[model samples]
Target chain A: EPEVTQTPSHQVTQMGQEVILRCVPISNHLYFYWYRQILGQKVEFLVSFYNNEISEKSEIFDDQFSVERPDGSNFTLKIRSTKLEDSAMYFCASRPPGLATFTGELFFGEGSRLTVL
Target chain B: EDQVTQSPEALRLQEGESSSLNCSYTVSGLRGLFWYRQDPGKGPEFLFTLYSAGEEKEKERLKATLTKKESFLHITAPKPEDSATYLCAVLVAGGGADGLTFGKGTHLIIQP
Candidate 1:
């Protein structure tokens, strides 16, 4: 079974530094998303990307956060300046084309753990 | 705002025991309800998608049922390997590009 793959399984960055988490979603999928889970918190949506554009974003995805699909296979989330509160596990997910509207079953990567200090 | 509440923050059962996990949701228009299983240090693994009220899906020893206001994940004859955090989420109609809104999740432990 094909799965979403994320790079840099764990990252530790200084406060005010920049970090970019990368993901390679399933090849044939059309929609991609980013979500994060703070320690002991529920998963929160960040943004969704489709057709090289952002479809929707949350308040948590503020000015400092951005996402890009620079290539056919890579989806990335960049934070301009990391904060202590930014520490969390970031997940990348993708959904197949035809099933996008029929179900909410998203295939997720193992996740990238970010630690800001 | 769409909200999902999962009951019984944690549960422990002996092997071969059976139980159910509850997910109560409040959303404007229900698009879909999903159930996922997550282990430590891993992302969520999709298990079932219930699109409408009265819909149900099953896999192995797991069965998921949906109603107008809530959903239930029933585990029958569970084993130690079934231990994991079960997450429930909701997709509301016209939710745009936003992804699913998740609950806090229920931690399940099955002991032999």
Candidate 2:
């Protein structure tokens, strides 16, 4: 089965540095999303992208965060000036549009673990 | 804010034992409730999505049921491979995009 893929399985960065996590969603899916899980916490939604623009974002998605699908196939999340609190496991996900399927199942990638020192 | 609460933070059961996991939520409008399984160092794998109060779905030894304010994931005759953190999430109606609000998750361990 086709699955979403992510790069830099683990990334260690210093405070005030920049880091970009990349993901390649399923080939045919249109809607894409970014979520993060802090150590021992629930998964939190960061943002959703479609049609080359952001549809919605959570409060946690601050000015320091941004997402792009620059190449149509690659979706990237850039965190500017990482902080200690920014250390977490970031996951990329995707789902198809429309109501054709009975369940709107979303597929997720293995996730990129970001550790800020 | 849409919120979800799952009961029994951790559970350890012998293989072939049966039990149920609970997910309670408070949301503005419910689009759907979803159940996922996550292992260490991996992302969540989809399990079931219950769209309405009376809707239920089953796969293998897992069964999920939904209601207005809560949902339950039942595991019957479980095995050691069934050990994982079970996560429950919700899609709110007229909420931000298709983002899902998730619960803290219940960590389950099945031992032989």
Candidate 3:
């Protein structure tokens, strides 16, 4: 089965530096999302994208965070200034929403682990 | 406010043992309920989707059952490979963007 794929499985960056995490969602998926999991914590939603614009975002997705579909296949999450609290596993997910059978079924990528120093 | 709560923060089962994990939620207009499995250092893998009360789905030795306010994941004759964190999430209609709120998860360790 086709799955979402992310690059840079692990990243270590200095606090205050900019970082961009990349994801290639399933080719045919129409809705894209980003989530984060702090160590030993529940996964938290970050943002959702569709039709080339941000559909919604959580409070955690504040001024420092942004997402873009720079091209047909790549969905990127950019953090303008990293913080210690930002260190976590970031996941990318996609789904073909609106279809009867596909509703609520999200395919997720392996995730990118970010460590801020 | 919408929330997903899972019980038994951790579990230990011997090979061939059977057990059930619980997930309780309080949300308005539940669109769907989902179950996922997560191994250490990896993202969650989708398992089942339950759309209504009294619905059930199964795969291999795992079964997921849903109701109006809770869901259960039952594992029968579990093996060491069944050791992982089980996560439950709820998609509430008009709750927020992307429609999901997940529990902290239940960590299961099956011993051989």
Write down the DockQ of candidate 3: 0.65
Give stretches of model 3 more than 4 Å off. Answer: A97-102
Winner of 2 and 3 under lDDT: 2
| Candidate 1 positional error at A72, Å | 1.6
For the record, the alpha-carbon RMSD of candidate 1 to the native fold, in angstroms, is: 1.1
Each candidate's fnat: 0.83, 0.74, 0.63
**Candidate 3 Cα deviation (angstroms), residue B91:** 0.4
lDDT order, best first, reads: 1, 2, 3
Query: In model 1, what lDDT does residue B101 have?
Result: 93
Residue A65, candidate 3: how far off, in angstroms?
A: 0.7
Q: Give model 2's docking category.
A: medium
lDDT values of the candidates? 0.94, 0.93, 0.91
lDDT of 2 by residue, B1-112 (tens): 7889998899999999999999999999888899999998999999999999999999999999998999999999999999999999998888445888899999999999
| lDDT string, candidate 1, B1-112, tens digits | 7889999999999999999999999999988899999999999999999988999999999999999999999999999999999999998878464478999999999999
Which is better, 2 or 3, measured by TM-score?
Answer: 2
Per-residue lDDT over B11-32 for candidate 3, one digit per residue giving the tens place of the 0 to 100 score: 9999999999999999977888
Docking quality of model 3: it rates as medium
Model 3 reaches an interface RMSD of 1.9
Assess candidate 2 and give its TM-score to the true structure: 0.97
Ten-residue stretch with the least lDDT total in model 3 chain B: B91-100
